[model samples]
Target chain A: MKTARVIYEDGKHKWIALVRDPNRPDYLIDSNEYLVIDDDDSLLLDPGGNEVFPAVFSALSTEFDPRKITKLFASHQDPDIISSLALWLEFNPQVKCYISWLWASFVPHFGGNKETFISIPDGGMDIMIGSQRLQAIPAHYLHSSGNFHLYDPKAKILFSGDVGAALLPPGEDDLFFEDFDRHIRHAEGFHRRWMGSDKAKRDWCQRVSQLDIEMMCPQHGAIYRGDQVRRFIDWFSHLEVGIVKG
Target chain B: MATVTQDTGRELRRIVRTNEEIKRVVATAFKINLMAMNAIFLAKRAGQTALGFGVLSNELRRFAMDLQKQMSQLREMTYGSVNTVTALVKQARLNRVLERARKESSGSGRSLIDEFMRTRHNLVFARHREQIAALNRRLSQMIADTAQLVELGSVLARSAKIEAAYGGAFSTSLMQVSSDFERTIGEIQRSLESLTKHQDATL
Candidate 1:
């Protein structure tokens, strides 16, 4: 079964992370799906692939109406990021997908039409959920060439997408990291290879460092809180990515 | 039970594929509507010499409008099927997960899975299946309606061709317009035939 944890909650606005399913097969990579609820309106971030749709849908249905998910934020066009799009749209035909303009055409192959997507430009834009304004911060080349991370100023949460994603081994399913060093170990190899550019990493680090964030949520692994958020930014800045060894 | 799952899976794939095909048909229908307008314009340019052609062209234009309206309705109906079939597929995947969970659990955990399977899972699955069945029936009806509309378009195209032969000095231009009508209507007919085949396979 998947676990849904409320990472941040303030009155009607809440951030719920549907994390870690033990029943998932060993081969399928585990992913985290975030639901940002503002009153009756909600947005689901990187809703995962088709394979994990049942788990994610059932988990979210327990707390929120999957039909009420008015918007979807795809960090990039990876299968694990937005492949469940068709299924989500199936459940709620009115849901509009917010993806980078670069992927507006390509991502629809997973399922959707012209009216279904709200394309965010390369410079990024503000997306409103109820009265709350969430910024789509451009984090291109951290992994996918056309990628953006979502930041909520009021909640001080930066949904980092694949930027801080870690491939944790079996039975290591804590929602938030207790040890920064141990957590960094799980994330190190992923950052070195999956993240394709040194310059992009530096730019992303500099831009996000200015933000007042309490929790940095990633798609694949545990969330970084408080001091670990800064520590992750620093670690990611120095990391030599796009490694092609002979 | 496995056969039912496989059949549902096939039906889901057919729904998605047919939806895409319907989009193409709708585009073609829009084009036919435009072509009909162009034919009326050309018939006016041909003057009194093409009076018979003008009247037939007007009828063809009306036929095109009716076809476009029907195609739009058919497209709208497919959305419901697409939504329901997609939900059915999701439920199937959940069933697999629940079965896996059941094998790994004991006592209360197993009982919980059993209860969910007996109640929520089964109930939701049956509901979705029924929705899909109803949508399929409606889809079949719409396809038949569209096929009949396409047949009417064919007759209008044939009559327009005969009328074009009486255009005297405007005969060549009128013939070209009539040919375009025939070709476009043929395309719509083929699309309908493909939809019928897919609908039959799905059923």
Candidate 2:
């Protein structure tokens, strides 16, 4: 079974994290899925892969109608990020997916036809959920060539995709980290190897540092909140990435 | 309750798999329409010598058209089943998750979970199961109807084979065409039978 926690809630608008599945197999890496509900419309971010669909969908159904989820935001095209595309579309054919224009043709192989996807350009764009606006900020090559992070201005939450993801050890099910140094130790190796470019890292850090983010959510492991958000950005800026150990 | 959830999941998976098999069968059935056209052409070439064969071929063509129409309907119904079963599978999964959550929680949390489960049982899970049963019933009925139509085609095919014997000089060609019709119709019947078995297992 998986658990969903409300990370942020302001009236009808809320950010729910579908986090932690104790039943998940050891070989499979655990990932986080976020649901942004703004009034009647909702968007699911990094909806995870096919293997986790049952757990994610079941966890989500406890709080919201999985079918009524109007939009899907794929931060990048990693299987862990959005491989469950077909299963999600199966339940709601009307729901549209937001991925980079680079993957518009590629992602359909998972499921869906032409009318199913709304292509987000290289520069990114504003995605609307009811009356609220969520910006798709470009964070290309941080891990994937065509990557983007979602930012809800009103919620002050940045869904950083894999940018701040940590490969925490087993049973580390905390939703948010209290100590930056302790958490960064888990994230360090992931960023060093997964994040391929120092320039792209600097670019992401510089741009993200400008935002007034209260919560920086990653696809994997715990989230960065308050001052830890800044601490992560600073740590990532100086870190060397894309190491060739061999 | 866990067993029910597991059974529902297994049944939904079978429905999806059966639906895919039916689609492939339907695609194979489309070739019957083309074979019917070839039979018509062969009947025309035989002229007055094969007048009886000509009439039987025309009837076979009509049967092909009717079968195609029924197949289109069956295809549409199976697609509806796919969509419904997909949703049902999700609900069953939700039931499992809620069950696990209930086991883990206590006190106020457990009561809250109980309330949520009651709502799901009444408003969602039960209704979905009923909906799926209704859809499966309709699918079974459709498959049966299509099978009856294929049996009629089989009769026409056998009749055409007898008529081909009287075609004089064109006997060999007409005989070949009638044999092709029998084989094609037989293939369709086997596929429909497979579909019926699948639907039965699911139900």
Candidate 3:
């Protein structure tokens, strides 16, 4: 539902990161990303299989060559998060796979018989695209152990895979919409309905609040703006505490 | 989170809802039957005290059997459909057999056909109309009670966050409404007996 595209660099090549579906939205394609830099190293963040591959390529735009992508980073084990990793890795022969060691157990499930990708160390990892650096913020308990949110710190944007996601209408490619309250409701509804455990909700909320969120490009639903941020947090607090009103 | 809580809350409401419905049918039959029975018991007593047992008592006692049959059927029906209607219809047949027996039992008493018809007219025509009206009133109350139950179910089903004090109040209110149903059945039975006695005397 929510996708983000931004240009970041001290100089040289411009970078575009596309955040695809996080939560199971209109499409089951799952969330992924494409980090497009100029003539050098193009990267993919969590390539989802089947339906999402086309979506990731389409969002990458014609300027970025699918085959020229030099790095593929899979944040977690979920088939939705990394099922298409091997497929994309096959296409780009020169690409290095940046697979998480904590989540490496998921490779077998994704039909990746070989452990070829380099590991992104726990706590944090940094990737350089020209002069700009992309930080992998640790996101644990976000469904599974091997998960991290990609933060474009300079752009003040958090690609919160499932943490801030909300399922929306299918084939909807809106990165951010004006009516963000509707998106907030969608996220709130999904949090309690699909994701179980009060402890989990509290943990996710705690982890996400630390980031200086500007454009909240979630995996699903419309992008929420500044005002909707506090509203969603307050709403989650009430649900977690079980304080029902008339 | 709310949905899980709402589902359990809805189930509790359903129990009260079903209990409320069963309450009405039981109450209605209870009223009609208790009235018809009283009519026979009192009617025969009147005939025995005023006239003699030979002519009126024996005739009226035969009428008591009809009332007894209907009462028996009404009792059976309280648990389920049972034989409430079939037994009532069978009473008509029993009346014929009993009528012949009464004639044999009393040599020159009045024709039981006339007695039976008159007794029926007193119950079905003169008394039952008013009893049925009262029954309808109780039925109306049952409707309102169930509507309240459904409203309670829907409200409780929506969210799991209402205060325990509010839930306790709602439960208490529903229980009170439930007790009223039983109390109403007793009241209806009392009212029907008053009328059934009048018709029961003539036969």
lDDT of each: 0.86, 0.85, 0.49
lDDT (10s digit) by residue, model 3, range A6-108: 6354344554655653433443544536463634665566666544554454455334545467776666676676665644544444566666677655575
Worst 10 residues of 3 chain A by lDDT: A21-30
How far residue B31's Cα lies from its native spot in candidate 3, in Å, is: 84
lDDT of 2 by residue, A1-246 (tens): 579899999999999999898888889999999999988899999998877876787778778866588789999888898888876764566879999999989888777789988999999999999789999999999899999999999999999999889989865659876778888999999999999988888888989889999999999989999999988898999998999667
Model 3 docking tier (incorrect/acceptable/medium/high): incorrect
- Between prediction 1 and prediction 3, the one with superior lDDT is 1
> By DockQ thresholds, what CAPRI class is model 2?
incorrect
How far residue B173's Cα lies from its native spot in candidate 2, in Å, is 3.2
Residues A132-216, model 1: lDDT tens digits:
9999999998899999999999999999999888988766768877988988999998899899989999999999999999999
The residue ranges of model 2 lying beyond 4 angstroms of the native Cα positions read: A1-187, A203-235, B20-28, B200-203
Query: For residues B14-104, what per-residue lDDT tens digits would candidate 2 score against the true structure?
Result: 7777767677667766787788888888888889989999898888888888887887887788777777777767667656655655565
Best candidate according to TM-score: 2
Give the candidates in order of lDDT, highest first: 1, 2, 3
Model 3 achieves a DockQ score of: 0.00
The DockQ assigned to candidate 1 is: 0.04
Error of 2 at B126 (Å): 2.4
Lowest lDDT 10-residue stretch of candidate 2 chain B: B101-110
Evaluate every candidate with DockQ and list the scores: 0.04, 0.05, 0.00
